[model samples]
Each structure stands twice: as structure tokens, then as C-alpha cells.
Target: MKTVEKIERKLPVLKTRKRVAAYARVSMESERMQHSLSAQVSYYSALIQKNPEWEYAGVFADYGISGTVTKKRDEFNRMLAECEAGNIDIILTKSIQRFARNTVDLLNTVRHLKELGIEVRFEKENINSLSGDGELMLSILASFAQEESRSISENVRWATIKRFKQGIPNGKFTIFGYEWQDDKLVIVPDEAEIIRWMYAEYMKGASRIEIGRALMERGIYTRQGKPWVDSNVKVILTNITYTGNMLFQKEYCEDPITKHRRKNYGEMPQYFVEDTHEAIIPMDEWQAVQAEFKRRRDLGPFGNKSLKLSAFSTKITCGCCGKHYRHSGKRNTAGEVYYVWTCQTKSQKGASACHSKNIPEKMLQNATAEVLGLDEFDEDAFSQQIEEVIVIGDDTLTFRFYDGHEVTTKWQSTAKTDWWTDERRKLWGERHKRKDTNPNKHLFYEFTGFIKCGCCGANYRCQSGKRKDGTPTRSWYCTGPKDQCHNPGIRDETMKRLVTDVLGLDEFDEAAMDAQIENATILDHTVTFHFRDGHTESRDFLDKRHGTPWTEERREKARESMKAAWTDERREAMSERIKKIRSEKKWPNP
Candidate 1:
């Protein structure tokens, strides 16, 4: 055996100090509470720094912020962030209530800190969170604190309700036309004039939007120094406070924890105090404005001065869906605007939702004239006598009059003859005439109208474009609505290759293809060729545009070029182009 020798190694040992942080908060903004918060901050700072084993990590103090929810406490959140960053080994707070009044929030925070191997020392409760029994004490004490907060909130709400019942406002509110002067509402002269002008314009049949626009044009703004809006105008018009009356508790806080303010809306009692302030407008004029508001509301959307009024705007209703009829218009081939009334449901959700037909505006006028015993339609007389026109079934109209009399009339649509005048027919013919001027149209022109979409059974239309290298490219795609058919477009080269392969030919021969095949159907991945002998042949086709010469590097370069080209201005222009296309297609706004 070899001789064994013992070797001792000496290494220097470094002492580590615990990083200590403190948190302090006050629930109210009173001067006394502010002083208390300051005192707590100073005490904690001195205490942590003076301790030999502790490395002071600063004191976090939140002034006049609640402890129930930690979100609102900025300093408290910062302290938690520092603790999570391993900068704190222990946290010193006044008590569990100061840490958090919410039982769940307190228990969750304590457990999270404990898992991080950090201890929280509550001076008032004399408990260390890292101890086994500390969590039980915190839970019981936190529940008591939460209950105390609830009792305080309830007492405050009771006091507020008592004040409301005595016709006293809870506090001074910010109104546009008036300001609080020594506990009383006093109207500002300039603002009062603007308020009077709003009422006058509304009485003169000017819409709230029009008034707001006028105010903006005059450089006038709301009390918040923002441009006036329709809602601002409406609030000024309907405010009873301007007539020296006060309405209390129009809105109230529903809960103490969430602090969500909800409209009263019969959920609570309201108190009204008359002669509470100097009147801007007389009570009689205010009542008249209210009556005008009611008249306009009863007349429906067209009654507002914003929309142009038509004789049958709100007077026509759908008998099938019980929805109001909406007015729509389009220009005929002769450039003449023709209007029609359609069901609201059918206009928005398409014919699948409602089977209502569009009634021509002219037909409606003729029917109304015939029912009213007039040779021509009279707007004034119709407005005064007719209440509503319900389109029942396909060709029947039931007109209900205000005098409790109803007339059922059968109508026939003459749209074919009415819309297709001699001039319109000539224009339509000219418009539909072959207008293709593509030099390479012959390459794919034979396939146009011969290839049908397998998904929607619509004809395929040929489109031509030029590649970056100035080489012309043609493609055939389905003409069916995109929402109904998603058949992919096929390149002209791919189509010819497919045809050649199916016929077992050396190259594409148009005459041979025309003589042997009747038509072709384009599916998602395969094309089915219909032969003249009543047989079909299916062949898979690939998009040649995605094949050879376009390597990964080239594709990446193209992607980078596209990204560079799509700037803010280009994005905005693309958005506008899409909007114009959707409008032309008569699609519903998204």
C-alpha cells in the first residue's frame, strides 16, 4: 500500500447581507393620512438601513391609494417587481391590511413571495410570512379588513342616498354651460348663448350633427376643449338643468370593489328639484323642444334632418320578416338612377335569411296613387293619410290608413320594359361588345367560356398580365362570386400542358383540342376534360408559376421587395382600393 497524506485547502468566505424593502400606503388623500404615510416611509427607511444584517433596497410608498386592489398602487407594484427580480429577501409592511385588504389578493401575494424564498414581516401583527402559521393569521385578519371596508362603503352609500332624498346633489358636477359658484349652479354668458343657439337650431329642424358641424366651423368646442359632437349637442338640448331644474342620481356606483358606475334606469329612485338654478330657457320652450323630439322619433330614421326624406322611406314594411324596408338605388345602363325598396334583412343578410322581393320605387308610387284615388302620387296627401304599406306575398300590397281603413291592391312589376328603354338597350349592347385589346389574347381566348368551375358551375374568365421580365402571362379563373367558389386560377401554360398530356399529343394543338374535347372543368387540384365521345379524363395540374427558376433565394428576395414596397401610404391606398371595390360590388360594409 502507498503512503497516504492529508491535504488541507484554505479559501476565503464572503458574508452576504439580506436585501430588505419596505412598502407603505394611505387609503385617503387627507392631510393627516399624507403625514402618516410620510412617517411610515421614513421609519421603514431608517429601520432597514440601521440593521447590520440588512442591505437597504429603498422604501416604496403609495400616497392616497387603496390597498384592496394592488393594480392601482404604483409603488406596491414596483416593490413586487423588485422582489421578483431577486433584489429583495424580506419585505417590511405596516400590517396585513396595509399589504392588502382583499383576502384572496393578500393570501395569493404571500404564497407567491413564500415560494420565491422571500419573507414578509408585518410589524403591526408581529408575524413573519415565511413561518408555517403566518398564512392562517393573515387569512383571518385579511377577512376582517375586507369586511371593515365593505361596512364603510355601505355607510357612505347610505349617507349619499339620504342627501339625494333631501334634493341635495352629492357633489358639484361639470356641465358645459354652467359652473359651480359657492355651491350653486351659475350659467356662463357665452356658453349659455351657445346653448340657446343649439335649442333654436333644433327647433328650426336642424339636426344635431349639423349644429355640431357649425360649432366646429366657428372654432367653438366643448368644455373639455375638444371638437363638438352630435352627443354633445344632444346633451345640451335635453338637459333639464339648463331650465333651472336638477335631477339627482341619474347614475350611481353599483359596487365598491369594481367601482362601476351604471345608469340608474329605474334601478334606484331619482330626485328632481325645480328652481334649483337660474333658467337659461323658459320651461315652456323646453317642453316644446321635447315634443318636437318625440315627433321626429316617431317618424323613424328618415324623420331626422340628416337623411333625405322619401315618400315611402319608413312607410314600407316587409310582411314576411316584419322588418322595415330600406331604400336602395343603382344606375341603369342609360345612366339613369333607379330606386327600389328592399327588406332590411334581405339587404343585410342576403336572400337566404329572408325571401322578400325588391319593390320598384315607381311601382310603389303607382300603387299608392291608385289606392288614394289620385291620378299621380302626392307626397303631402300620402304622408297625412297613409300609415304604412305592408308587402304581402309576391305581388300584393296592403295599405293601412290612419283612419282605420285598409286597401289591398295587386301589383305587377314591369321592370323589364321600364328599365330597358331603346337607348338603354343600345348602351347595354355597346358595353357588352368584345372590348379585349390584349395582343396575346389568342393564346387563351379559346378556353374562355369553355372552362367551367367545378365548385360553382360558373364560366371561367381569362385574365392577362405582364411578368417582371416583360413576358406576357395569361390565367383562367372562375367568374363566380368568391364567397361561393374558391377554385384556384390555372396558368395558360399549365392548361395547355394538361390538355396535351390528356390527349397524348407532342404539343398543344388548338384545333385538335377543340375537335376532341367539348369542355373542361377546373377543380381545386385536378382538371376534368370532357371528350366529344361522352367520356372524361382527369389530370393533375401544377401551378407553373411556383415551379423552377423561382428558387428559395429568389422567393426570399421577392418577399423582401414586397415588404419594402408596402409602406404606410401604400397600405392606406390598398385599404381605399378595397373599400371602393366592395362598394362597387354592393357588398355589405364589414
Candidate 2:
């Protein structure tokens, strides 16, 4: 063999150069940090180029990003991807903390890289990731880094709350009418005047909508230069800040990882600093405003009708349509104003949707006066004592008193016109030139308010048609859309058939039914009637929720949320929990 290899022969085999990349990061974007990051990039580039056995892959740097989260670091993710693609042999980072402060994330990433035959070398730690003890050291050190970050966050939060307790504002925060000057809230004169006017107007019975409209009409914009809406006006009115009071800890960050802010409603302590700034509204007036707000809210739906609304206005509910009767006025040419309450659903959505007719407000009040056993009921006293007036059918009124007493009274129908009737035309028409300015109103069915809509809980209105002979024909329907109600309307004839046949009622007596039935709720596929005796019954119906298909945006959002929920950190935590549980207990059999 030696004698045969006398001639000179070359046996050197070419070796591929190791592709090396570097990663650098700074948590904050300070001037010093920026320079440090730039220096790191330059150093890594020079170091890789100068190495004969290594090839310069790239240098990845993230600025103003936290080292704890790997998801938000763009450059770091890119380097990891390159390493997995076999484009990089080794990753050189300043230290383990610079790579990742989260121990789980760092360990997972390092283990993943090791499996792919890629190495991570921490310069400061002088640790090679390919070594056996690298991960154990990395996990311990990274955990310390995570704790350090948490400590800093906790300390900052503590300082903020401490300052808040001392009535010293932590930082400058801008509001509509005030600016922070040297940690003191100083009101802008012009804005303060606007706030004062708003409070005054609200006390004078102007609604938030009215106040907002007035501001918009005057071309007055909010501090943010946006058109003021009702909500904005309401916020300004409700804010105690305008009353020279400052409330702190109204909101808080949920955690450092997610960094989501939530309204602090009893979740934490709040500090109230009174007279912290110049008052836009006096203390007495603010108290009065709160009392008024409570009064309106306690009254439920009726109190929200109108700001300048008089006592007892729109306080009556049309039982058939489940809508508050709207107050209407008509002139009688005698210079007298005749007020009547019309069904809102009937008026807005038309008679087809709601057949509930109008009721004379004056006549109804007289009956109420009689029920209260008073010679004459004052509007103020009546409003205070009366909880609500539910008008069923055309003439029946169910009055609920504040003292928990209920009274049902019947009034003469105003729809039956005596002057226009053919039988009485000869007698009364000749006296008034065959025309009566005032006409009687009569309802076709007494169940307009008696029978309520199972869907919207509104009263069933009486729908009648006039035959050639002038006799009445009637049916019923729901006017849900007019009242912004989602439940579909049911025909009165259908309800009557269902009630009389199933419940075995005599004349479908609403008064008797009202005494026995608590409520009737309708869903997509069934109607559940709750009786006063706690008995329940359900009837099948077609499902309605299967209308619209899933939207593209909704589908995409679901995918992204699913991915975010199964993050590496969350996965590791779940895995470790499972491992601990497995080590603690073992099942004997399936």
C-alpha cells in the first residue's frame, strides 16, 4: 500500500462554514439603550465576519419591547425561524435575560433549538446551549429575571397608590374641562362655564340629549374636537370631578403580561379628594341632581320618556302592545286642549302591527281619582302614589299603587262616535249641522289590554274591520319592531284560540287570567307560560335563531383567539401542572 502511493495526492475535503446570528434587545427605548443596541448589532456583525470558520447570517434587535414575551418580539422570532430552517448554526445573544426573561419560554425555545441541532451561546453567561447543563442554568437564571421584572412592576404600582392616598396626582391626565398643571387640576374658564350651564339646565328639566343638541347647535365641540353626543353630555354631568372632587383608582391594569385595563369597581380601594379644584357646580345642586337621577331610575321605563314631561304623562302602559302610551293633544276649537294617550306601537308601527286604540287621558284620570277615593286627584299626589296604570282592552285600567294595592276599573270607550252614528245623526247632526266636533270612541274587543303579547309582554291590541253593513270584524297582532323589540308578533285570533282551547277559559276572562298567570315568555322554539301557582307549560314552535351565517371576520377572530389562548407559556404551565398531578396520583384502571 505504501509503494503504490508514491505520487503526490490531495485528500483534503471542503467543510461548510457555520452560519451564525446574533440577537439583541432593550426593554425601554431610552437614548442609552438605543446606543447599546446599535453597538451590539455592529459588534455581532464584525465578530461573525472576522471568524474564518463562521459565516455572517444576520443580527436581530428589538427595541422598546419587553424581554418577558416572545410573541411581540419580531426580530427574535425571525432569528428563531431562520435557525429552524437550517439557515443558522448558532445564535449569539448578550445574555439569557436579553433572550427571554420568562423561564418557561426560554427553556422551551432552547430545547427546541437543541433538537434541531442549532446552538445558542450566551456571551455574558459564557454558556453553550448544546451543553447538557445549559437548560438547567438558563431556567434558574431566567426565573430570577422574571422575578426582577415583576418586582419593578409591583414597586411602581405601590408608589402610584401611595401618592394617590396623599392626594397628589401621579401623572398628568387630561379631561374635558380641566388640565393638570404641576399635579394640580386647573379648570379652563371656558370649559368650566359650559359645565356650569349644563348642570343648571339639567336641574331646570333639560335632558342630556337636549343639552348635547344645544351644544352641537352652538358649534361647541368637545376637548377632543369631536361632536358631543348624549353619552358625552351625561358623562360630564355625572362626573364628580367638575364639582371640585377627584376620584383615584377608578381603573387598573389586570396584569403585567396581558396589560389589560379594567374599571375598578370595588375591586380595589378608591380615594376621593374633595375641593381638589375650582367647583363648576355647587354641592347642593350636585346632590339634587343625584336625587333626580335616582327618582327617574326608580320609576323604570316611564321616567325616561322626556325631561320636560309633566307629571302622569306617559305613565300609562298599553297592556295589549306592552308599550307606554304616548301623550297626545288635540284642540277642540273651543280653545280647550283635550289630551289622550295613544298606543306608541300602534302609532309608530301602524294599526296592522298594534290594533290598540287611543284612550282619553282625562276620562282615565277621573276613574283613577274615584279609585283613590279622592274628590280631586292632584297631579303631584297621583304621580307619587300611583306605581303604574296598565290599560287592557279598550276600557279596562289596572292601577297598581305604591302601597302594593291593585285596582281594576272600567271606563266608557271614547271610540264609539255618537254624533256620527246613523241612528243618532238625525237628532244630533241637525243640531250641530250634521257634524259633531267631538266624537265618541269605542273599541271592538275588551281584551286589547287584557290579552298581552307573550313575546314582548305588550298588551294585545284590538284589530277590527268595517263590513258594508258597518258591523265590526276583529283580529290581533304584535308591533314589536316599532318598540325596538325582537320578539315576533302573534295574531290575536291565534292567541285567543290557543288560550281558550288549552286553558279552557270561559269568555277568555282576562281579569281571571291576570289573577292566575304570572307571566308568559316566548323563545325561538317554545312558549312558556308561568302561572301564579308556580305551574309551567311549554309549547313547541319553529326555531328562529338559525338565520344569519357566520361572518368571515368572526371566523378569523375565533382562529386568532384560539391560537393566543394556546401560547407556549400557557402550554408549559398546563404541562407542568399535569406532570405534577401525574406524579402525585395514578389511576388503577381506566
Could you give candidate 2's per-residue lDDT for residues 1-590 as a string of tens digits? 45665677889987889999999999898999999999999999999999999999999999999877899999999988898788999999989889988777889999999999999999999899899898788888888888887787789899999999999776777788888777677878899889889888888877778788899999999988998787898788778777788889888978765556898889989999877888777878888888877887797655665553556666788888788887777765434566777888988988898888687766776787898888876787788889898888877889999999999998885434622467655544333321122243132243433444566655445566765889765654454555565554444455555555547776576556556665555544355667779897766544233257789999999999999899999999998898778778973432
Residue-level lDDT for 285 in candidate 2: 84
Cα RMSD (angstroms) for every candidate in the order listed = 22.4, 29.5
Top candidate, metric lDDT: 1
Model 2 — TM-score against the truth? 0.45
* lDDT digits (tens) for residues 100-181 of candidate 1: 8888889999999999999999999999999889999998899999988778889988999899888889889899889999
Q: lDDT at 531 for candidate 1?
A: 99
Q: Quote each prediction's TM-score.
A: 0.55, 0.45
- With a 3 Å backbone cut-off (N, CA, C), the pairs that clash in candidate 1 are none
Candidate 2: where is the Cα deviation over 4 Å? 1-14, 70-89, 104-118, 127-131, 193-235, 283-590
Candidate no. 1 TM-score? 0.55
